[model samples]
Target: MSALAGVALEHPVMNAAGTCKSVEEVDSFARSAVAAIVVGSITRQPRTGNTGNVYWPGRVYSINALGLPNRGLAYYGEHLPGMVERAHEAGKPLIVSVAGFDVGEYQEIAEVVADAGVDLVELNLACPNVWDGGAQKRIACFDPGQTAAICTAVGDALLARAGGDQAGRVPYGVKISPFSDPAALAELAAVLAELAGRPGGPRFVTAVNTFPNALVVDADHRPVVDVELAGMSGPALKPVGLGQVRQLRRLLPDTVDIVGVGGVGEGRDVAEYLRAGAAAVQAATAFWNRGEDPSVFGSILASWIDAGGIDPVDSAIR
Candidate 1:
């Protein structure tokens, strides 16, 4: 079993938050082999976000400005308990993803979810769409100080709100922006390494959240969504994801765990990520297009694991 941020997972494959639904969305997933299931991003207040068809097209990619639409805290709180129970019954780790505009919003949402008994919390510190109200502009999140501030705030909040062994038991981590510059990525990793030395700090990071913007317009040539840019995620993003894993591995301390999520479509993709530095890997878009095939990419990974081709404990930076 692989453990990240104190959550012990039976496998290394996890569904990215917002991409995968609760056990309620795909009934078959309840009994599937996915190590963890990250629920939708929950916010302190409900947000309708930008409406209409927000998904944009690409030759081998797609851009979206969904505005991080969510069911808000109250409803999520009411429904999440049942979701968590169902996931637990099916023997899967439950991770709650939290997002917000600023420190207060992020902290409040995380505290509420932690109280709901999630095994871990994924903080979205670098959501392109949410960063500037659909400006869709691409900005780097490679600044270690900026990255550390956002993560530390959420981490401290989680630790404070969930005091006791229970508090320490639920570890916190952040997701990074996909288009991070090499220097920025190194700086961010350095910051995370520094924070790891603090009394209570984040346990891991899900590097390279999504690929840089690849805006696609509708047939009318008008923007699909109001946002001019959108985050890219799919098979095309795998290489960038691997680069992030390697970069972070080199800069971060050994204690810091990494969960790679970007564009993993096959077992080899997972293997590449693991060899790079990820303790675990998450594939969103590929599985999203595969429909009900829970084993779409997982079967490949299983064979690799069986063959010992993928090592979850390998932390090599390059």
Candidate 2:
């Protein structure tokens, strides 16, 4: 059941990886709706993240510039055990979203958390600037070959960490960044297909992390953040997210599972991602705007599923 490939979540609605904080931070709000709460990205090393305001909400949308600040493996080991216990008390699964500078670091963290007792581990390949050489987000490694190599390296490390036969005991999946070309996506999907065929590799892929960075100038014509551009996410990115998921579904073999995430704000959004062929779905901005209240979207999705509602399908694409 730990195989993320096609495992049914306790609930269809899940909190997006970085959007929600620690269990204690949103416990009351998450009690009702979220079937699972993924703690923020934890790295191999401790990070204080970026300084300055990380969240800037607008009329119908919000902008976030928070650098990925985490307690690292040492702190996560101490903090997450308690969080997982609490989520279990509420009958919710706890997925730990983790990032590492490279493959070795990723496996190291996965092994540590698996030993500590996490239900699933989400390998965040889209984290902003956590890699070496000061590479920024999206631009970290645009070459398809590089992406495939990175994934395969990480996937292999995870398999090794899980020790093959016990791979089923710990689920592993990667959240992919949106790369424009279909050929590039197909190439990356091919790599995943190869790994999926291997002894122990990832079973699922989460598509299109935040949108490519934006250049927004204030009244004084000054740009925000220390970077030249920042990624955009929210309702505005919905269509782009849909397209990426739809394409990945088309490119990936049917055997490979996909988790659709990005610009999801409601049951309808989850339904759309499912329609695009995601085995599971997640959101960040929605939870940010609606708070952690589970019923905010979970009940709505559960109710829709209870009814003989329209099922999203790839056949509908034409």
Best by TM-score: 1
| lDDT (10s digit) by residue, model 2, range 1-318 | 112454545445677777555556547534756656677678888777766655554445555656677777888777777887877878777787777766677777877777767777777777643434475544433555655555566566556666666445566777777777778777777777776676656667777677656666668887755554556677777777788889878877776777777777666777787788777677777666665354555655554454433233421221
lDDT of each: 0.71, 0.66
**Model 1 worst lDDT window (10 residues):** 131-140
Query: How big is the positional error of residue 83 in model 2, measured in Å on the Cα after superposition?
Result: 2.2
lDDT agreement of model 1 with the native = 0.71
lDDT of 1 by residue, 1-318 (tens): 667876777668877776654446524566666788787677777767666766654556656666677778887777777777888888887888888766677777887787788788888776667645535433325556566667677677766765634335467887888644677566677777888877557788887776655676678888776766677887677788888888888888887899998777667777778889999988667665665466764675565565565455662221
Model 2 segments more than 4 A misplaced: 1-4, 26-30, 59-61, 129-146, 161-163, 224-228, 291-295, 298-318
What is the lDDT for 98 in model 2?
78
Supply the TM-score for candidate 1: 0.85
Query: What TM-score, to 2 decimals, does candidate 2 have?
Result: 0.84
